[model samples]
Target chain A: MKYSGIKVLWEGLRGNMGWKPLWRNPDPKKSYDIIIVGGGGHGLATAYYLAEKFKITNIAVVEKGWLGSGNIGRNTTIIRSNYLLPQNQPFYELSLKLWENLEQELNYNSMVSQRGVLNIFHSDNQRDAFVRRGNAMLMSGADASLLGVNDLKKMVPFLDFQNSRFPIKGGLWQPRGGTVRHDAVAWGYAKEADSRGVDIIENCEATNFLVKNGRCYGIETTKGVIKSKKVGVCVAGSSSQVMGKIGINLPIESHVLQAFVSEGLKPVIPGVITFGAGHFYVSQSNKGGLVFGGDIDGYNSYAQRGNLPVIEDVCEGGVALMPMVGRARLLRIWGGIMDMSMDGSPIIDKTNIKNLYFNGGWCYGGFKATPASGFCYAHLLATGTSHHDAKDFLFNRFEKGRLIDEKGQGNQPNLH
Target chain B: MLIDHPLLGLRDSSEFIYMGDAKLLNRPNWKSKNSKTKFIDYGYLRKNPGGVHKELWYHEQGDRSWLVVTRNTVTHEILKVELARYLKRKENAK
Candidate 1:
C-alpha cells in the first residue's frame, strides 16, 4: 500500500487493519541470473539498483536470518563522507549523495539526518591535520569547514572545554554528514527490490557454491541448490568463513566492535561529536537516547557480545568529553563482527574465481558505505567493469604495495 | 575477561596486549624460493576461524613475555595458556 499522511488517518478511522507485510516471503526459485549471498543493506541495495538502474531483475537475495539481524541494524547509525584519502573520499561522497535522495527514491523513511558531524581537535598538530583533511574533503567534492575554538564552545557548550588534560582547541565540521535510521535502509531496499520482481529468500543459509573449473554456477543452500550465472558475496564479518567454502582465504580477519546507547533523556547533543583525545564518538538519537561507541574489542571473535574492559574505556572517554553523560545510565550495548582488512580498507573486486565476486573487509565503516557499495558492486556485476569511484578497492593492492592505509596504522586489523 | 597466565596466575585481560591469530607464529622465511608469495599469505590471509583459536598476547603490564592462549572465539572461553618461548616458530626451524 502507498503510504502518506492521509493513509494514517484512513487507517486510524478504519480500525488500523489494512497494513500488510513489508516484503513477501518467497521460496527459492530454481535459477536466477544473479544471486546475492547476504541479504543485509548492501545485498538488498544491490538487488534494488540492479532492477531499477541496470534492468536486471532475475536476482535472488538469500539471507540466513531475517532483515535487520546484521551490522545494518547493529551500527551506531552515523553517516559521513569526511575521509582524507582520495581512494576513499569520492566513493563515500557518492554514498552521501545517495543518502540525500534515498527516502524519496525508495518511498520509505530511512530518516537521513544531515545534522552535521564535529571532530574536535585537542592539539595544534591535530588542528593542522584537520585543516588538511577538510581541504581534501572539499577537493573531492564534499562539504567541510574547520571551526574555531570559539565556534565550538558556542555550539556544544556541554563539552569539557576548559580541562587542562586535553583541552578542546577546535573542530572539523561536515554539515552534510549525520545519522540515518540504519535498519530502515535494509527494509526500504528490500521492499523496493521485492516490488520490482526480485526475490528475497530469508532463513535460507548458503552452505556452499557450485564451482566447476573456477566458474561459479550455483549456490547450495539449506533449502536446496539454486543455479545462478553470477554470485556476489558481501557478507561483512562472515566473509572469511563464507568464502572459505570455496577455499578462498581473504586478507581479512573478524573482530568484534561494540556500540552502546544510554537511557532516554531530554535533548542535549545537537549533532555527532567525537572526542579527539580518545577513541569515542556520540550522537543523540531521535528518541532522545544518546547513542555512542568506541574502538573494537581488539581480538578475533564471532560472538555478538563483548567484555567490560572496552565498555569502561568508552565510558572514560565519554566522561572526559562530556561530564554530563557520566550520570546517564547505560541501557543497551551490542557487538558486530568487523571484516578488518590488512590495510584497513575495503575490497570490492572480482576474485580469481570466475563469476564469483567479493565485497567486504569493511571493518567498522560498513554502515556508512552501504549505498555506494551496492551501487558500485551492481555496476561491476552488470557491466563487468569497476565503477570509477570504486576502482581503488582492488584485491591486488597488497601485491602492488599500494596500501590505502587511511590511519597509516600498519598491518593490524584491530587497530583499524 | 581473565587470562589464566601460566606464571602470573589469574589476571585481568587489560594487563595483556592482544596480537591476532597465533598462526603468525609461523613466520615466512625470507631466503626461500617462494618466499614472496608465502610472505603475502603470511602477512595477509588467515583462517580467522569461528570456533577454536590459538592467539598471542603480551603481558605488557606484568611479566613482559608473550604467551600463546588457546580460546574459543564463539564463547571466549580460555582452554589453555603456554609460554611462547617454549613453542617452535616453525616445524622446520632450527
Candidate 2:
C-alpha cells in the first residue's frame, strides 16, 4: 500500500486497520536469472535497482536470517561524502545524492535526514587535511563548508572547547549529510523490490556455489539447490566465510565494531559530530537518544559482542569531547561484524569464477554507501561493465598497486 | 580480555596493541628476482587460522616490549608469549 498523509488520515478514520505487511514472505523459487546472497540493505537495494533500472525482475535475494539483521540495523545511522581520495569522493557523493531523494523514490519513510555532518579538527594539521577533503567534496559537486570555532560553538555549545590537551580548532561541515532510520531502509528496499516482482526469500542461506567448470551455474542453500544464471555475494561481515566456501580468500577481515545508545534525553545534538582527536562520532536519534560509535575491537573475530575495554575507551572519548554525555546514564550497546578491506575501500568486482560477483569490504562506510553500492552492483550484474562511479572498486586493486587508501592508513584492515 | 605476559604477568589486552601474524617479521630478501611476488604474498596474504596462531603484540603501557603471542583466534586463549627481540636474537644465533 502507498503511504501518504491522505492514507494515514483514511486509515485513522477506519480504526487504522488498512496497514499491510511491508514485504511479502515468499518461498524460494527453483531457479532465477540472478540470485543475490545476503538480504541486507545492499542486497535489497541491488534487487530493487535491477528490477527498476535494468528491468531484470527475475531476481531472488536469499538471506540466512530475517532482513535488516546485519550491519544495516546496527549502525550509528550517519551518512556523508566528505572524502579526499579521487577514487572514493565521486562514489560517495553519488550515494549522498541518492539519499537526498530516497524516501520519494522508494515510497517509504526511510527518514533520510540531511541535518549535516561535522568533522571537528583539534589541531592545525587536521584542519588542513579537512580543508583538502572539503575541497575534494566540492570538486565532486557535493556541498561542503569549513566552519570555524565560533560557528561550531554556536551550533553545538555542549562541546568542551577549552580542553587543554585537545582544543577545538575548526571543523569541515557537509550540509547534505545526516542520519536515516537504518532498518527502515531495508524494509523500504525490500518492499520496492518485491513490488517489482523480485522474491525476497528469508531464512534461506546460500551454503555453497555449484561451480562445475567455474561458470557458477547455481547455489546450494539451506532450503535447496537453486539454479541461477548469475549469483552476487553481498554479505557484509560474512564475506570471507561465504566466498571462502569456493576457495576465494578475500583481503577482508571481520572485526566487531560496537555502537552505543544512551537513555532518552532532550534534543541536544543538531547533527552528527565526530571528535577528531579520537575515533568517536555521535548523533542524536529522533527518539532523543544519543547514538554513537568508535573504532573496531582491533582483533579479527566474527562475534557480535565487544569487550569492556573498548566500551570504556569509547566512553572516554565521548566524555572528553562533551563532558555532559558522561552524566547521561548508559542505556545499551551492540556490535556488528565489519568486513574491513586492506586499503580502507570497498571491492565490487567479479571474482575469478565466471558469472559470480562480490560486493563487500565496506569497513565503517557501508551504511552510507547502501544506495550507490546497490546501484553500481546492479549495473554491473545487468551489464557486464563497472559503473562509472564505482570503477576504482576493482577486486585486484591491491595486487595492481592501485589501492584506494582513503584514510592513508596503509594496508591495515583494522585501522580502516 | 587479559593476556598473561611472561614478564609482566596478567595485563589487560587494552594495554597492548595488536598486530597480525608474527610472520611479518620474517622479511623476504628484496634482492631476489621474485621479490615482488614474495612481498605481495607477505604484505597482503595471511593464514588467519581459526585455531592457535602466532601474532605480534606490543606492551605499550607496561614493559614497552614487542611480544610474539601464540593465541587462538576462535577462543582468544593465549598459548605462549615471548619478547620479539629475544626471539629475533635466537633466530640470528640459529
Candidate 3:
C-alpha cells in the first residue's frame, strides 16, 4: 500500500489493522529475464530501477538471507559525495541527488536526513588537501564549503579543539550530505521492486553459475536451479566467493569492517563528524545513540566479527577527537564484509563471461553509492553499455594502468 | 589476536602492520619484455582464498622485521610465522 500522512491518520483511526507487510515474500520462479544476486541495498535498488526506469519487470533479486542483512544495515548511515577524483565525484554526486528524492520516489520513510557532514582537519597540510577536495566537489556540481575553526566550534563545541597530539584546525563541510535509515533503504527498494512485479526470493543462495560455451544463462542455488537470460552479482563482501564459482577471480578482497553504537544520550553531535588525524567518524542516531566506525580489520576474511585490537584503536581515535565520548558506554558492535578494491574505488562492469555483470568493490563507500550504483548498473544491464558517469569503473582499468586511486593508496585494499 | 613471532615470542597482533599477501615479495623484473603483463599480475591480482593464506606482517613496534604469516582467513588462526628475509634467502638459494 502507498504510505502517506492521510494513510497513517486513517490507519490510526482504524486501530492500525489496515497496514500490510512492506514487501511480499514470493517463492523463487523457475526462470526470469534478469537475476540479481544478493538482496542488499544495491541489489534491491538495481531491481527497483530495472523495473521502474528500464521497464524490465521480469526481474528477480535472489538473497541468501532476509533483506538488510549485509553492509546496507551495518554502516554508520552517513552519505556524502566529497570525493576528489573526477571519475568518482560525478557518480557520487548523482547518488547524493538520488538520495535527495529517494523518500518521495519510494513512498517510504527512509529518513534521508540532510543535516550535513563535516570532515575536520587537524593540520595545515590536511586543510590544504580538504580545500582541494572541496574545490573538486564544487566543480562536479556538488555542494561543499570550507569551515574554519570558529565555524566548527560554533557547530560542534563539544569537540576537543586543543588536543596536544592533534589539534583541530578546520573542516570541509557538505551541507547536503547526511544519514539515512540504512535498513529502510533496502526495505523501500525491495517493496517498490516487488510492487512492480519483480520477484524477491529470500533464503535462496546462488551456489554456482550455469555456464555453457563461455556464456552464463542461470545459477544453481540452494533452493534449485533457476534460469535467467542475464545475471548481475552485487554481493558486497561475498563478491569474490560468488564470482569464484564461475572461475572469475575478481580484483577485490573481503575484509571485516566493524561499526559500533553507544548508549543513548541527548543530541550532541550536530551532524556527522570525521576525525582528520585518524580513521574515525561518528554521528548521533535519532534514538540518541552515537553511531560510529573506523578502519577495516587489516586482513582478508569473510568472518563478520573483529579482533579486540581494532576496537581499542577505534576507541583511541574517538577519545582523541572528542574526549567527552570516553565515558559513553558502547551499547553494541558489529561487522560487515567489505569488498575492498585495489584502487580504493568500485567496479561496475560486465565480465568476459557473456550475460554476467558484476557490481562490487565498494569498500567504505558502498552505503553512500547505493542509488547511483543501482541506477547505473540497471543502465548497463538494459543497454549493454556502461553508464556515462560509471564508464571509468571498468574491470580492465587495472591492466590499462588507469586506476582511480581515490585515496592515492596504490593497489592496497586494507590501506584504502 | 596474539601472533607468535619466531624471534619476538608472543606479541599482540596490534603491534604488527598488515601488508597483505606474501606473494608481494616476489617482485617482477621491470626490464623484462613482458614486464607490463607481469606488473599487472603483481600489482592488481591476488588469490584471496577464504581458507589458509600466507601474508606479510611487519613487526613495526617490536623487532622491525617482516614476517610471513600463515593464517586461516576464515578462522583467524595463525598456523606459522617466519622471518620474510629468511624466506627470500631460501628462494634465492633455490
Give a tens-digit lDDT track for model 2, residues A95-180.
99899889999999999999999999999999988898888999999999999999998999989999999999989999899999
**Candidate 2 chain A worst ten-residue window by lDDT:** A246-255
The lowest-lDDT stretch of 10 consecutive residues in candidate 1 chain A is A1-10
Model 1 Cα shift for residue A47 (angstroms) = 0.9
True contacts kept of each: 0.84, 0.25, 0.57
Better of 2 and 3 by DockQ: 3
| Model 3 segments more than 4 A misplaced | B29-35
What is candidate 2's DockQ?
0.44
Per-residue lDDT of model 1, residues A19-69, tens digit only: 998789989999999999999999999899999999999999999998758
Q: How do all models score by TM-score?
A: 0.98, 0.95, 0.97
Candidate order (DockQ): 1, 3, 2
- Per-residue accuracy of model 3 over A63-170 as CA lDDT, tens digit each: 998887988988999999999999999999999999999999999999999999999999999999999999999999999999999998899998899999899999
Model number with the top TM-score: 1
Q: DockQ of all candidates, in order?
A: 0.85, 0.44, 0.69
The candidate with the higher TM-score, 1 or 2, is 1
